[model samples]
Target: MHCRPCEPRHPDAQRGVALVVALLVFGLSAALLVAMQSEFTLFYQRGSNLFLAEQGHAYLRGAEELATLALVMDHDADQSREQPRDDLGEFWAQQATPYPLDEGGWLVGSLQDLQGRFNLNLLAATVTGTGEDGTDSARFTPAQAFFIRLLQALPELQLDSREAIALTQAIGDWLDPDTITRPFGAEDDFYSGQSPPYRAANRPMASASELRAVANVTPELYRALAPLVTVWPQTPAPLNIHTAALPLLRSINGDGELVPLSEMEAEALFQRQRSEGGFASLDALLEAPAFADKNMEGVRSLLGESSSWFLLTAEVEVADRNMRLYSVLHRDERTVRAVARASGSL
Candidate 1:
C-alpha cells in the first residue's frame, strides 16, 4: 500500500512556477526603476529652476549697479553745470538699450524720478490752526491741496472736484495716526467690516500700490493714479517739475481756486522745460503767461528742479527664466545708493 511518495514534479510545472516568479520580480524591478527615475527627474527640474533663478537675480544685480553708475555719472555731469537738475533729456532718463550678455540673455534697465509724481504720504500732513468757524479742525496741507488738484486735472480719471477731495481725505485717513476719520474718509472702523476684516495702515504707505487697500479705490482708478503718484519720501518731498507728467504740471495753482493749467498751456511748459533743460528757478516758472494771474505760492513750494528719490526698473533674462527687479535709489551729494528693492513688480 506504499504510495508513489517519490513522484517528482513535471519539468513543465516547475518551469511554469519559475517563469511566474521571474515575471513578478521583473515587474516589481521595472516599477521601482520608474519611480526612482521620476523622483530624479523632479529633483533635476527643481535644481535647474533654482540655478536659473539665482543666475537671473545675479544679472539683475549687475543691472542695478549699472543704473547706480549711470546716476552717479549724471550727478557728476550736473555738478559742472551752473544749475544742477534732473530732466528727461539727461542720459540716465533715456530708455536703456538691452545689453547682450556674454552668455545667452539680455539686460534692460531705466531710471525714473519718483519726485515727478505726487507723494501720497503728504496727505497725512495737516494744519490744525483754525477753520472758517474758528473751531479746531484738520485742514488740508498745501501738498494735499496740490494732490486734489492733480486728481481733478487727470481727465482720464474723470473725477470731479468733490470726488477728488473725498479720495484725498480717504488716503489721509489711511495714513494719519489717529482713528478719527475725515468727513469723507474711512478709518479702521470702516475697514473692520470688510469681508476679510483688515484695518488701516495708519502710517506711510510702502508703495503706491497700497492705494488699492484704501476705500473707494478701484482697479481702474489705481492704475490711472499709480503712475502719477508715489509713496516714497514719506516726509513731504517736492515734485520735480522737469520730470513731472503733464497732469501734475497742470495741477499747479494757488489755494483760492483749483485752476489747473490747460492742456495747451501745460504742453507749452512741458516743451519749454525739455528744450531749456528745465526752468532755471521757481521765479522763471512763474513767469509763464498761464501763471501770471494765478497765485504761485503753494505750487512754487511743491515744485523743484532736483530729485532725491528715483526708481530703477531692471529686467534680466537667462536660461529662459525672466526676472524683473525694482529698486528705490536715493541720490545724495556724495553718491547714489539703493534703499529698497522688489522682484517681479514694484
Candidate 2:
C-alpha cells in the first residue's frame, strides 16, 4: 500500500497522559488511607466506651452491696436501743456526702426510709359495709382522710378544694377493686375518655410516682405529695415523727378538728421532740401537747418503733455516661434483703 509511515505521537501529550494516570492512582490511595484511619478511630472509641460502661456497671453493683451491708449493721444497732426506733438520728438517715472513686468519677448514694411517708395503699385496709347498690362498696379510712388533709394543706400543691377531693377520690378508687367511684373520684370510664386513654388500676399502687395518673393530680401536687406519701408494703408504716413533715403530722391530727394545732404548735412540738432522740413511743408523742385530745388509737396503729423498708438511690457517672440505680431494701433483725431493683442509663 502506498503509503506514508504514521507520524509519532506528540511527546508532551505522552507525558501528559502519564502524569494524569499517576495523579488518579495517588488520589485513590489517599482517599483509601483516610477512610481506613477513620474506621480505626471509630472502633477505638467504641471499644473505650464499652469498657467504661462495663466498669461503671460493676461499680454500681458494688455500691448496692455496700448499702445492704450498712442497713444490716444499722438494724442490729437499732435493736440495741431502749426504744428500738429508726429516725433521722440514725446513721442510715444521715445525709449522704459524695465519696470519690479510685478509678474516676464520684459515687454518691443515699438511703431514705420509705416508712417516713404515708402509705396510700392503706386505703384498702378498711372493711366495707353494704352500699346503696348492695355491692361491696369501699369505706373511707383514716389514711384516706389524712391524704385529703395533706392535699388541702399544701398551698404549693396548687390544688383547689375540688381538685384535692377529686384526686384523693381517684386514688382511692384506683386502690379499691370495685368499680364504684366516690362522688369526686374517677373510674375507668373517666380514664377511657382521655386522649391517650388508659384504664384505672384497681389494685395497690406499685410506686409513689403513680399518683401522677390520678385525676386532678397535677404535676405540682404530685411533687409536693411524693415526698410525704408512698404506696409500699400495703400496710401503713409508722411515720418517724422526727423526719415526717410537719404538714403530714398536722394532717393526721385533722386540721378542722375541735382543737387543731397551729403551725407554730406543730413546729414547736417537732423541735422539742427531736431535740435529742425521736419520740420513744406513741404515748410520748401523744404527750407532745399538740395532739392532746386527738384520737390516737388509730394513729397509734400507724406508728412504728423502727423502719423496716428503705429506698436506696445510687448515681454513677463514667466517661461522660451516667447510670442510675434504685433499690428497695427491707431490713429486719434477722437479715437484710433487696426487695426490688431497677436500673437505667441516663
Best by lDDT: 1
In order, what is each prediction's RMSD in angstroms?
2.6, 4.0
Clashing pairs in 1: none
Runs in model 2 with CA error above 4 Å?
2-11, 125-127, 130-139, 158-163, 234-236, 254-261, 320-322, 344-346
The global C-alpha lDDT for each of the candidates, from Candidate 1 onward, is: 0.83, 0.73
Q: Over the full model, what C-alpha lDDT does candidate 2 score relative to the true structure?
A: 0.73
Number of clashing pairs per prediction, in order: 0, 0
Error of 1 at 68 (Å): 0.9
Q: For model 2, how does the per-residue alpha-carbon lDDT over 74-125 read when each residue is reduced to its tens digit?
A: 8788667676677777787778887788767877788888888888887654
TM-score of structure candidate 1: 0.93
